[model samples]
Target: MFIDRLDAGTKLAQALKDHPLVQKIALADRLVLSIPRGGVVIGKKISIQLNSRHDVILVKKLGAPFQSELAIGAIAETGQPFIDQSLVNQIRVDDSYLREEINRVRAKIAMYKTKFRQDKELNLAAHLTILVDDGMATGETMKAAIAWLQGQEKTHSKTYHLSPTTYLIVVPVAASNAATDIRALGVELVCLEESSDLTAIGQFYERFDQVTDEEVIKLLAKN
Candidate 1:
């Protein structure tokens, strides 16, 4: 268990220090892309420890109709959406609902990019790209970021040379199922703990509090 997000970030940053990829990639070539607002705390620690660039990766969960807490999937800032077909099929979700949710979630992502990043674009030309989150339960948001990065690699391979040697996901804890799904994406993962019967990410931290947009803005500014 962690005392708070700061403690989790410290531990995760230490773990990254011993990672094989960290040994191969130079500090200047490492880019830490954190998912706000809690993940920004983690990302700050990582960037400081690794002496790398830090930035926010905007992605929002697509909540199910009448169930805002339940995520059907997620959409990233690049407008790439990852829908959980199995969940949608089980819930009998229709295409129209998904289309609407996509538009709404994508709009929120754009707003975050403007507010948190001031409409600044990310530099994807790094040797190692690290994605950090406080913890992962369903892992949809992180997957959305990965999907968008993969798309960039394909689309800008020759034009911009945007392919990184490695893409790593770091989190203090992750649900076992979500870990498996994330590994299937072919990215390296550094998880301090994997819970088979995971409930909520807050359960692992004693001082888990909601992070505000203002706090996120400050953290990004520090980077």
Candidate 2:
């Protein structure tokens, strides 16, 4: 198990150094857009190691009603919301409720972007954009993030006429099933460990304390 997010980030950054694409890409051409507030900790270390720009990509989980800890799916700041139809059906989530949740989450994402990010613009023009997170459970939020990047690429092509960014997902640990689903999205994934019996992300970390908004802001400021 990792000593903490910093330990995981160091290992992940080391693994990234061996990737063929990362080896070829210049540090200036790489951008680390991590999901906050945990991901910012990981991303900061990566950015420092690689001498790359660091930023946050906002996405929020759509929690199941009553069981708020259980994620139904997720919605990115931009792009279509990703919902697990099977899970929704199992939990009997209705369309109206889903709509309301999406709207609510989007608003929260907006507030976070403003609060945590201020007026910093998203750097979508990087040659390689690495998505870092503490871990992947259902992988819904990461998928939503990938979709958002694709949408940005489409919009960018019309104006700047540039090649699409090479998207990569990096995590300290993940469930085997979630890793497979992430790979199916066609982006490169670098995970330290993939376990079939993974219970929670915190399980793999020796000290998985909650990352605060202030910590996230400080990390981003360093980059």
Candidate 3:
């Protein structure tokens, strides 16, 4: 367990130093996209360590109706989103409700993108993309984020105008099942821990405070 996000970030960076990706590609050829708000903290550290450009990925979870804590899928503001078909069926969600949820989530994503980011977007065709999050539970949000980088409508605040070539996922910890799901995405994942006993992500940390928007803006400014 880590003392805080900074401690987790340090450990993650140390573990990544010997990775073949770092050894093969020059750091200048990488771009990191962080899933805010906790993710930006770790992403900034990894970006600095890899000497890569960093940006934010604006994504929101599409929670199942009547149980908003349960995530059925996730959506990106300006690109294709992803949903778990099995979950949708299990929840007995109608097509009309699903469509409505997608629209609602997309609007929220757009607001976050506008509020947190500006005129810039990651041009994925040029550099190896890296998506960083604090950790993973269901992995739905991260999956949608990956799709955002690779899917159609590769545009953002402006037209991003590119397609994904190669990408990586980085995180401090994830549920054992979540790690498996992430691996199925066909992207390399660098995680500090994948534990079957992971009841919650905060359980693996000593000081897991909420990362505020103010903190994200400050870190991005420094980067």
Candidate 4:
């Protein structure tokens, strides 16, 4: 039982089963868009259980100055990722600095897109999009992913005549306030653990290994 609990993949699957949003969206029809790296493992398990389309959404965070683990912004599949402007301004990050970081992220996105996003444009119109991540501390990455999805809805409306889009955010653990902020975006949010006492995401899990780009690519290749 201890080895069973220590398995991140198994724990992730069980957590998703208990998640309210997962119960609602992991039905017969839906697509799961998991955040790259850690989320890929969770997404794979969910895909097996739900028998639905599963794909990865590459979202990279722009680290805060002097505190690299602290994210001030994040880049999703789209061109411009979401940035907590107020936080950036409060931290005294000038526009030039932000631009430099954003451009760097865009380059990374381009590389990922070439490697992974070569499929037909995701027709999220009238489809359920479930966004997943391994964990959440600040929620900057999830926020950016949501904003990017919204942008896709708008841009695709002009070219492809499709209906509105629906999205959901699913994570294993998240800060209470960060979960609240994500819920305010008017989309369904699922978190197995929401603790106000939380400080770091890795603290909640026993094995929090760093996932590399090559590993992520290999995982997604199975989809």
Candidate of highest lDDT: 1
What TM-score would candidate 3 get against the native?
0.87
Model 4 lDDT tens row, 24-135: 6636457777787788877777676666678777788988878878889998776676888889988998888788888998898778777766644554533567788888
lDDT values of the candidates?
0.87, 0.85, 0.80, 0.73
TM-score of each candidate structure, all chains considered together? 0.94, 0.93, 0.87, 0.84
Model 4 accuracy (lDDT, Cα) = 0.73
Error of 1 at 190 (Å): 0.3
Q: Identify the runs in model 1 with alpha carbons over 4 angstroms from their true place.
A: 159-165
Q: Mind giving the per-residue lDDT tens digits that candidate 1 earns over 3-91?
A: 99999989988888888988888887888999988999989988998899999888888888888767789998787888988999999
Ranking by lDDT: 1, 2, 3, 4
Q: Considering every candidate listed, which one attains the maximal TM-score?
A: 1
Query: By TM-score, highest first, what's the ranking?
Result: 1, 2, 3, 4
| Clash count of each predicted structure | 0, 0, 0, 0
The model with the greater lDDT, 3 or 4, is 3
Displacement of the residue 41 alpha carbon in candidate 3, Å = 0.6
